[model samples]
Target chain A: MSFEPITGRYLTVSVEGAPRRIYVEEAGQGRPVLCLHTAGADTRQWRHLMNDAAVTASNRLIAFDMPWHGKSLPPEGFETQEYLLTTEAYIDTVLAVIDGMGLDKPVLAGCSMGGRIALQLAALHPEKFSGFIAIEASDFQPAWYDIDWFHRPDAHGGEMGAALVSANISPFAPEVERWNTLWMFMQSGPGVFRGDLSFYTKDDSLIARLGQIDTAQTPVHVIVGAYDLTCTPEDAERTARAIPGATLAVMDELGHFPMSEHPEGFRPFFLDALAKMPVATAQAA
Target chain B: MIETFTHIQSQLDASPHLLRLGRLFSETVLIEVDGDEYYLTFDKGRIVQVMQGPSRKTPWRFALRTDAAALSEFWQPRPAPGFHDVFGFVKIGRGRIDGDILCLVKNLRFFKEVLGLARSKQEQAA
Candidate 1:
């Protein structure tokens, strides 16, 4: 059986100053959620969730190519995960897209790298969002991260930028190996490596800065695949622990992508997370 | 306020002690519910000093005038309770406080208890 997204496309937008083509898709509406992808992958990671009743019944979900991959191409050398994932640049592109759509602060949801961006976005500008949900966010525990692994010698981070690009954002990848190949391709691109490095070796102090997100009253959902090695189960707890009153749900027998690996697993949690946001908002006062 | 205090981070309310140990507070903590700030000194995630900020009664800055003696009386480490139990405390009156208060959960595992899986499928296969 092949997985397909209900609404999908290679769209374009001029946000974060540079005009970039972003792979995009939009479906349903109640609340809006900006879906984020992993370092090397495009929005395809969230493809399974689009048709999910939990998502469709409660909110509008939107996802697009990050600056350099998919339909949105960043500069040839925009390799700074620090820059690509910075709250300023990341927020600018998202807000631009939001303003482009004229919607209020939507629930910012992402997994792994995307989750890192979601955390920063929530922290830097809590006023702009309704709530945030993340799956094993990288920035969740910045202090514990192993920075050296990102730069392993076998990892070709700089030279294959172009090939890495093609592998990452292609509209259609035929098989799981092809998809996995595309997912792993980021290690070869200079821009994505820096982005990965930025993710793994951040100085943002999210560990200490968690209290700043004010989750005691805000609804933030932190999800983790029990067997996710990329970020690991311990890392998920660290992230969940960082927020006050934030919901932490660990998927059993689940790997990296909860929304994809187990839609049955993630659905109820997604609905619950959605349900929690409004109460969080009402309670925030 | 400090004498009535307990460890009051955002992660405390749903912490594991309630499920595994059938308890919420560790024997040590006294609690204060002022406004935004939640200060705690713990032994096993038990509340020794929960210096919460002012309730809806005053502004968050009120925690500044904390009762030092009561707070100091409870600072020690014990096996932490469920880390998430602070959620209830935060929800009660501190619900709107800043995100920084979540730091008080001494041991993360108490709150981050993973629900499903006793063993991995990959392991079972092996």
Candidate 2:
């Protein structure tokens, strides 16, 4: 229901080796914001927010389909690999995008896996990202850090219960909802979830590693919907703890994809973040 | 097709409150008696842009862009903040209204007509 009056044509890029298809909307171009979608969500996830006055007024919103998820082709057998690898591969792809698009460093904004990827990319190549606005990024570990872990709906649960699990997925459409869920699950597969969970849930902790990194000192803004089912308020608090001084904006009556769910609320918040970022970063296209 | 005006002429014609506009450079008038600077532009007698605010660079005023294609086929009803069933015509790019306040309120009818074009366009598309 929340959509911006903006649409973009599709694009293909050579990230992590092969060609990947992406979509971008350039409106009232100024500085650029490279947007990454959550796991299971393509660039379409940011469709409404891209149209947000904050993004369109003074910035170009660049959204891309994660490999194997949208129009992009997951490398041969790579689809069978773990997600951490996908994240690694995706970073390379994102780097290629910056160079390919001939864009100077941009602020990286993403949600969920997209959020985690943003953080990882910033950690690895902080110079490329001028800032971060990660929303409901997955717990470095799904089991340990995740206060509420995703699971197969209890078999003992009734069809009504099963319907709840199914509905949490794609809200649109009826038939093939199961396939939709399976397809969604396959893209982020259990393997990747387990692998990332190891690093995220490791006794060692990724925050320590992230804290140690002396990358580009870009501003970080952390956001989570007040009603986020995936990343609870606690998770958001912890995220702020890890990224000291991170601006945390919580939207009411919004879910995991708050920006998409409640643009009226999220738009202003995101703009405020942009308004606060270094003027030069936001000033340049 | 409407005739296009250079600067001030365009501002005078598109504006519903022209008398209050006085001069482009002399006075920065709002829509009503105390509104923002509202301007209307026409090319070949056809209106191209209707704006309320200071200028076009970063239109703080809500500048609704429209062409003939938009005017003829007003978009069908959908849902929005101000409209009941009208989606209004889209004039490409984002709409900004900030400088003058009254300019927006005074130009609602003219804006609605242009938006009507968008509303029709949706009907054809759907």
Best by lDDT: 1
Residues B30-121 of candidate 1 have per-residue lDDT tens digits of 23433234444444544334545443442321112222232232121211111111222222222222322222122222322211011122
User: What ranges in model 2 sit over 4 Å off?
Assistant: A1-12, A23-26, A76-85, A144-205, A213-216, A280-285, B1-126
When just chain B is superposed on the true chain B, each candidate scores a TM-score of 0.23, 0.34
lDDT of 1 by residue, A1-285 (tens): 965436776645676566766668877666778788766556666666787765676577888767765556665456543333555566677777766666677778887677877777677777777888887675443422223333435434432322222211111223353344345444334445456546445645566666678775356888775445455567778777776777787765454555554555567776776776763234345
List DockQ, one per candidate, in order: 0.01, 0.01
In angstroms, the error of model 1 at B114 is 32
Docking class of 1: incorrect
lDDT of 2 by residue, B1-126 (tens): 222223334444455543232222122222211224456443433444545555545323443333333333322243221122111221122222344323333333233333334443355657
On a 0 to 100 scale, what is the lDDT of residue A43 in model 1? 66
lDDT tens digits by residue: candidate 2, A1-285: 875566666667776666766655544476778887665445655666666675677777787665554555555677455444355566777787777677777878887667777777766787886787777764363541221132223211122122222212212122343333334333453333333333334423345545643333777777776544446556776866676556677655445555554455567777877775555443353
- Model 1's DockQ score: 0.01
